[model samples]
Target: MKKVVITGIGTVNSIAKNCEEFVKGLKDMKIGIDKITQFDTTDHKVKIAAEIKDFDPQKYLDKKTAKRYDRFLQLAIAASDEAIKDSGLENDGEWKENAAVIIGSGIGGFKTLYHEFHVMEKKGPKFVSPFLIPMMIADMASGVVSIKHQLKGPNFTTVSACASAVHSIISSVMLIKSGEVDVAITGGSEAVIDPMPIAAFANMTALSQRNDEPQKASRPFDKERDGFVMGEGAGVLVLESEEHAKARGAKIYGYIAGYGMTGDAYHISQTDPEGTGAARAIKNALDMAKIDPSEVDLINCHATSTPVGDKSEVRAIRNVFGKNATNPIMQSTKTLIGHSLGAAGAVELIASILESQNEFAHGMPNLDNPDEEMKDLNIPKETKNQRIDVVLKNSFGFGGHNASLIFVRD
Candidate 1:
């Protein structure tokens, strides 16, 4: 198999709009959750979300193009542009064909759907915008990114709920390892902060109701934790075969050592109670990476702060890591940035890379005192300085989809 390495990374989250800023925010333990501002949440039970504030799509894209795409696509385009430019491939004409794009989204253009429904109800079906269908499809993100960068090779979108982004990254690596592509831009984007989706999630009891304390709302792995705070943004990385990267003198950040994916046939909206499916995915990823559980320096957990979900993931981690799991410094960035859903895996992957690169460990937030049921783990209280070699990122979504990615220092 061809060796694949990460040459560039780009991210836009509730905390920051680029990788450097995002990493700095992570180190500072900045929390981005706040009352929703994108839509009226007066009648909703869940009113808080980590929204991408002060974002103007016209700044990155023309008004005409911006109007045609949804906020999710806009985020993807912005992140992809940054990744491509950071990869130093914008002017390199020779390898354009070898470049591809793979992106994922759990809920694509949800705002668009809501708006069109409102239009059909208030005015008429004929009043719906012509771009409605194209804007609402999940695959449009991949299409828009490919068209923006003139990437003509393999391109598609993955839709495994929260595992969507990890799946996309894994697929991209497979393409490069197969020698079908030399480089690929892969990640996920999501923007479902509209009233309809918010109300829907609230009705299903999947979101936090801490409207008064938005900052302290998403306390993952904590006894007081209620539910996840919704977040919107994108995370993207540039992947290239090691040989191709060396030939072009690309700066390497890390290596995509391994990836594992699994699905539980048990439920559509809940995880397996025993965590068997999630545990299997983590073990498979470790086996593929040829690394022992003791070698994992950090784990960016998929704890979404839900009552049952967070505990289930804790059990899964313990099952896979065994004794080494006792003091494994685990942190959930979701506490700071809320849950970006599909884009979460990519965002958390960036956090894992930063932790490995800087050797900075973070403690669980809002949980000044952890519960005894929260497992015996060394959850970081503040960002600590330490050397890290390997990191594992986990993303488990609705419908029992679980994905894990292993990253090693270059």
Candidate 2:
């Protein structure tokens, strides 16, 4: 079996549009959630999201290409471009022939769907653009990215809600381990911070209603937490087999030690209160890595600020680590950038990689009062400088999907 390692990473999110900015954003604990500006939210119950500011796709793509793709696809291409370039794989090479593209998106091209719906209602179905079908599908994120990069190997999209991106990463790792592909551009992108999604999530009571306090709306693990703040962004990583990367003199950021995925099977949209499946996912990842729970130095939590989800994740951690549950410093990047749905796992994993590389763990400032279950947990509210060598990241989605990954820095 081949060892899979991460060679490059890129991101475009509310707090940072690139990896450099992301590092600084994490260091400063920047809050990116605020009043929504993508549409008129005067009549909505939820009006806040972590919207990317000054996002000009033209900076990363050609004008025509940028204009033709939906926001979700644009973000995916931008981040993939950065990751490929960062990996020094932009130039022509044999790797391109067998490289895979497995980008994931929970809700892809949602903006296009929302727009085309109004186009048909106002005008006629014939008036809709011919590109509507190709542009609005969730799988297009992977298709368009493969086309842009000319990657010819396996290509597809994962659509497991919030777990979508992590599943993609896991799939990529398996492909590499099985000698199916030498390298893969895998992650997730999301751009559904539109009025329709906001209204839908709000109606379902899955969004924060603290419109007046946008910055403090994403208070994960806190007693006063409402719900997750919607965010829009992309996180892409370039992964290659250890031998393939080393042969080309590539720079390796870290190795994907192990990964695990499971289903709750308890509820359609809610995690099991006892966190049975989630604990299994974490344990499986640790077991695959051949590392004990105490070996983990940092935990990038999947706590999306939702009351049930936050409590459930803590319980899962306690269930797995037992007495050492408080040993690893756990944190949630969502507290700063909100939840980007399918992109949350990839984005949070990128945050974990940066923290491990920089030797610091970022905290959640919005956690003013942690709940009783969180009292014994080592969730710092302020960034702490410490040597971070091993990281365990978790992501759970609607539909009871749960995924966990372990990254080890050598």
Candidate 3:
């Protein structure tokens, strides 16, 4: 089997518009969650979200193209463009036939759907957009990315809720390992911070109600944590076979050492309190990496700040790491950027890679009071500069899906 490696990565999140700013944001322990400004929240309970401020898609795309694509697509394309360029991939159709695009979006074009639905209701069906279907479908993200880059190989989207992006990356790794593609652009994007989804998630008690303290609301692993803060963004990475990357003299960021995916089969929205499936996923990833639990240097947890979810993930980590439970410096990117849903996994993975490259663990600024269960774990409340090489990134989503990936520095 061929080895899969990451040649480039890019992200556009609430904390930063690009990877360079992202590094500074993480280093500064910046807080991006704040009161929602996109829509009036007079009747809404959850009033905060990590929204991209002053987002002008025209900066990354041509005017006509920017006007046609949805916000999710714009974000995906913007991030992917940076990744492709960073990887030194030619867009002149040189590698089109041997390349693939597999981007994931848990809820694609939601903003478009909501707008069009209102258009049809308020005006008329005839007034609705003819571009609604193409923009609203989840698969369009992958399709649009492939079309933009002229990548003609395997093209599809994976929609497993929050695990979507990690699953997409894992699938891309398989394709490259199987020699089905020489290069793959894989990651996820999400832009669903609209009123409807916020209202739905709020009604389900899946969001924080700390309206006054929006910046400090996403208290992952903290005793005062309520729930996750919604975030919007995209994270993209360019992956290639080890041989292919070397043949082209591409700069290798790191190796996708191993990955493990599993289903909880326990609940649709709630993860198992005991974290059985999550533990299995972590163990399997380490096993595939052929490394002992003690070898992991850092962990980017899927800690969404929900009371149950935070404890459950820590339990899973403890179960898998055993005596090394408190060894790795663990942190969650959600603490800084809120939860980006489908894009959470990929964005967090990119943050992890940055942390590893910088040799530091970003702090959890909102963690005022640590959870009792996490007392033994090495959860950094302040940025800690240290050597980091092997990192584990985990993301579990709705539908009982669990995915974990181990990345090693090249």
lDDT of every model, 2 decimals: 0.89, 0.93, 0.92
| TM-score of every candidate | 0.98, 0.99, 0.99
Report the lDDT tens digits of candidate 3 across residue range 1-410: 99999999999999999899999999999999999999999999999999999989998889988888899999998889888888898544677886889999999999999999999999999999999998888888889888877889899999999999999999999999999998999999999999999999999999999999999999999999999999999999999999988998899989999999999999889999999999999999999999898999999999999999999999999999999999999999998999999999999999988888888889988878899999778988899998889999999999999999999988
- Candidate 2: where is the Cα deviation over 4 Å? none
User: TM-score order of candidates, best first?
Assistant: 2, 3, 1
lDDT, model 3, position 409: 89
Clashes of each: 2, 0, 0
For candidate 2, the lDDT comes to: 0.93
TM-score of 1: 0.98
Which has the better TM-score: candidate 1, or candidate 2? 2
TM-score of decoy 2: 0.99
- In terms of lDDT, the poorest run of 10 residues in model 2 is 60-69
State which candidate has the highest lDDT: 2
- Total clashes for model 2: 0
